[model samples]
Target: MFVILVYDTAVERNPKVLKTCRKYLHWTQRSHFQGELSTAQYRALMAALDGVIDPEHDSIVAYTTRSPDLVESTTLGLPLGGPGEIL
Candidate 1:
């Protein structure tokens, strides 16, 4: 499946978070990332993130699909359920 993990944190701390994400995903843009993985990889990514993220400030939204639904869903005015919406 394909996954788009959207995240937000302090500009200074973003690099660390991004680095961790990059270890598991492909960087598509400055703040956006995409990747294809099995359920195990997805769970591993989430587990790593849970230990590293600070919920008081930082937020991570991991959306998964079999295709590029992230961009399509946004353009189609779909509701993204997470900490915040991208559109």
Candidate 2:
């Protein structure tokens, strides 16, 4: 699956969240990441994040599709960290 993961974490837990996300996806910008993963990988990524985040304090959203081509995005300004889109 192609996944775009965005997270907002408490200051004290921020580094762990970032580190976990990076292990599974490309860091596209601050608090944002995108990449491809197998179904197992996707589950693992979420599971890993769940361990680091406090649901009461952190926010994580993931957009996913069967293939990268099924998604599209436009960048209004300079791309940050790299492109934010799957393509």
Among these predictions, the greatest lDDT belongs to 2
Tens digits of per-residue lDDT, candidate 2, 1-87, equal: 999999988988988988898898988888888999999999999999999999998999999999999999776676856654431
True-vs-predicted CA distance for residue 24, candidate 1, Å: 1.1
Question: What local lDDT score does residue 26 receive in model 2, on the 0 to 100 scale?
Answer: 86
Query: After superposition, which runs of candidate 2 have C-alpha atoms over 4 Å from their true positions?
Result: 82-87
TM-score of each: 0.70, 0.89
Residue-pair clashes, model 2? 0
State the lDDT at 57 in candidate 1.
88
Give the Å error, residue 68, model 1: 4.9
What residue runs in model 1 are displaced by over 4 Å at the alpha carbon?
67-87
- Per-model CA lDDT versus the true structure: 0.74, 0.88
| 1-87: candidate 1 lDDT, tens digit per residue | 899888877676677777788888976555667788888998998898887778888888988887655456343343333334222
TM-score of 1: 0.70
